[model samples]
Target: MMTMHPQTPDILPRVAFVATGGTIAGTMTEDSKTSWAYSSAQRSGESLVMGIPGLLRRAQWHFEQPYSIGSQNLELGHMLQLRAVLLRLLESPEIDSIIVTHGTDTMEDMLYFLHLTVPSHALGKPVLFTGSMLPSDHEQADGPGNISGAFEFLIQCLSTNADVSGHSAMPFGLCMQGLFTPAHRVEKQSTAGLDAFDGPYSVLANTQWLLSRNALEMSEDSGVQGQFASLFDPTATRHPLFEAMEVPVVFCTPGNGPLRQLTDLLNRKPASVVVAAPGHGNIPEACVPVLRRLLLNGVSVVRASRVIAGGVEQGGEFDALDAFRQAPVQGGNAVFSEAGGLNLSKCVMYERLRVLAHSLSV
Candidate 1:
């Protein structure tokens, strides 16, 4: 644990700032000044902090880069590597919290993955995520301000011991320009706007200006269940990705066709097939027979929605197919488990399906 100086009691927490390469770490040509025209993953996390004056003196923080790639190109291997780093950090008694500086493109997906896989005991301290719409060196770049917001939020949480229910309820947070959002509820609504995040949920903190002086405030608990809680075997010591890496999977959006393509995908003997459909997880009626054939063949089938929020409803098309049952893989029963909560985002549903495919048969 980092010691606190009596003269500066404020500098009491120890933090780990993990970087996974994003627009927040981007840079441009010496003459270029606009955020739109720049190369990404050019700057290290250390360099990003240095760009923000007085950041180094804020806390006893350390930096580590697992990999540097654009979020658009992020793969399963990269996510697993990041999960490994987070596990190591969260287990450290010396670290009070973590702040991930990433690109905004896949931040929600990344957060959802972490939320599902990371154990509750390991996530005792807050693990927050932040990024910039603009590059690090843009004249009006948003990286520094976002980082500052995260740092300040951590300071407040550590100083006050932010546990409302006598337990650490919110182990992860997403801090943007001036708003601190809950990870599962965060969404990137715009491509280039400074205020690009929106949540149908409540804001955790709204620290507008007064970066150095304002106190952090808490909002009502969103009551988000660890809905995908059964997806992982809690007793397992190794990260879930170890098995997930071996699974060959397919993610597709429903369309007009004879479903020959779906048959081709199943021929590979994949662990599961994820259908990203429209309007509460409904797919074309033509695709149903093929899907039913695949489901009957012991292949796992998952229904996920493309909508930002509100999961799928149970009795609609799913009832007609009689697709109710636990996922064949170890952890979850998949769509058969429940309705309403199953309507997951396309990316999140794909990840859950991956976990299910890799899961050991019970």
Candidate 2:
């Protein structure tokens, strides 16, 4: 049997806390309005440890970046920078774990991105992502508790070398909401509840590593890693010289003018368009003509719902099939192009286009 070494001074785990401003570092005013307002009076990431005395006493702490921003402001570039930083830290022989203090609003999206970007071989150290729904300045803030929990979790993860293989096998990506995987699979159980991430799968019991090294090795050998990397590198400049493909996203609102404006935008940019239907991917009949014009101009129009819970249904009440056929008929396009479902889909499509472009160039 392999003997596990006890954590002591000789084997003390070093932890890096990367704080990229979120509610975790946000300030609340005396009026009780939660805001992303930063105050010089507020404690910094380094001060967080002092704020919660005795927390993380055994571990060495390092803060990557201080000053919090709302998660809504997080972008792809930020994700890239964070990944590069994490990779750099992972290369360090002393660092044993990493904790990211993020805002809960878009934490899952960021976590999934990190999940895809961080290499498994370089991921031996524990990487715990945590945040609180309440601001740190709130009188009844959960930030302190959550941060404490995250630190404890990281220590435990490093001590045990928990198995993360399951995470690696996920076909889509991991979405951690209050400690639940595929966070979309779980719904927020309570409005201000501590166990907001409660799901049917009993997530609290399954603290094992989401993905294993062996699985990553197999996937890497199969070239999946390379393919995924190529798909995600949006800065790739090479492209095939072919008929332009434009995708348009039309946001349907109470007024018909928004759709018309979108159509006008689509006309200006000669590419396929994906209409972000207001409800169940439904567009107003008044806006149908705008879509029709784009189709007439050879632009492919796809339907995507703005609703976050459910996806766009095919051959549904919206006459989606006919509309698609009337258009140039490219596949579905995402309404938003950020690091969510839409971005993930776009990444896959872009990868295919890149491969085709490379083939054509050859």
Candidate 3:
């Protein structure tokens, strides 16, 4: 643990910053090694902090770069590894806050994963996730301002133990552009704008944002059945990417042509299947038989919408399909529990954690 001093500089909060490569660390290059426009993770976390005007003296910092690849290249294993890093950092008493700089493309996945895996009681301090749409070298890059907002939010959380509006905030949140939103309610609104999110209603850091559903439904609980309260366990051996690709997500497209075949499930039934069903989670009637067979054989299924904003409804298209009673996996205790009111992307994450947690203890 880093010891605190009673002097002037030491009074600034101590921060643990993890830089997982995203556009915020990107740089333009002619090489074909990186994704889309430029090479991400071209810059290091320490360099990002040191280059930011007036940020060098704000805090005592510890930096680590777990990946420098683009966000599209980041996989499930990376998230689990990052979770382990966060748990380790949370153990240090001298650390007042933690921040992760990532790519905006999948920033919500990182944020929501932390929200689900790390509960309030486990948080002695707090963690913030931030990233930008444009590369760090862009003339009007948003990464620096976003990162600055992270530090400002940390100062308030440490000093007042409350948000800018003087209300308590959740342990996991995202600070970006000019807004601060608790992790659970965050959403990316556009790909073209700097202030591209659609939650939180403030210019300064705050968590008074509203949610569409009951608070109780948005679980901060760990794996299924309290499974030791969280998957953020730093000590347990991990199955980071264990069978991550097996839980197939089938998309519901227009027209009733033969849907994608699931003959593979008959031989090696996945623990779960997340269907990105058409409008309001209407699972096409054609695929019903195979799904039912899988269900009886101990495979789980979740119905979700492909639409960006709305959620799938109960009794959507088929009454029988809408109601799900799942069974445990063949050899593992994980269950891809039925849930509602989450977008398709979020549903994928929710089920992944549910089914994956038991493979290796969460």
RMSD, one per candidate, in order: 5.8, 7.4, 4.9
- Using alpha carbons, what is the TM-score of model 3? 0.81
TM-score of each: 0.77, 0.66, 0.81
Report the lDDT tens digits of candidate 2 across residue range 45-152.
766666776765767778877335677776555666666677777667666667777766666566545544455555555566666666676677777777776666
Tens digits of per-residue lDDT, candidate 1, 252-352, equal: 45444336666675576455565656666676676777766666665556665556567665656555455446544243333322224432443444444
Q: Write the per-residue lDDT of candidate 3 for residues 1-362, one digit (tens) a residue.
A: 33333225547778899999898998866652464467788899999999898887878899988777788787776877787787778777767679999888887776676666654545556688899887887777788888998877776656654432322343466788656766666677788788787453333464333332134234432222123335545654355355344667777787643254454665788767777767777778777877766676666778766776566555645565433443344443323333476665667777766666654553
Pairwise TM-score winner, candidates 1 and 2: 1
Considering every candidate listed, which one attains the maximal lDDT? 3
Overall lDDT per candidate, in order of appearance: 0.63, 0.53, 0.67
Leading candidate by TM-score: 3
Cand. 2 TM to true fold:
0.66
| Candidate 1 worst ten-residue window by lDDT | 213-222
Sorted by TM-score (best first), the order is 3, 1, 2
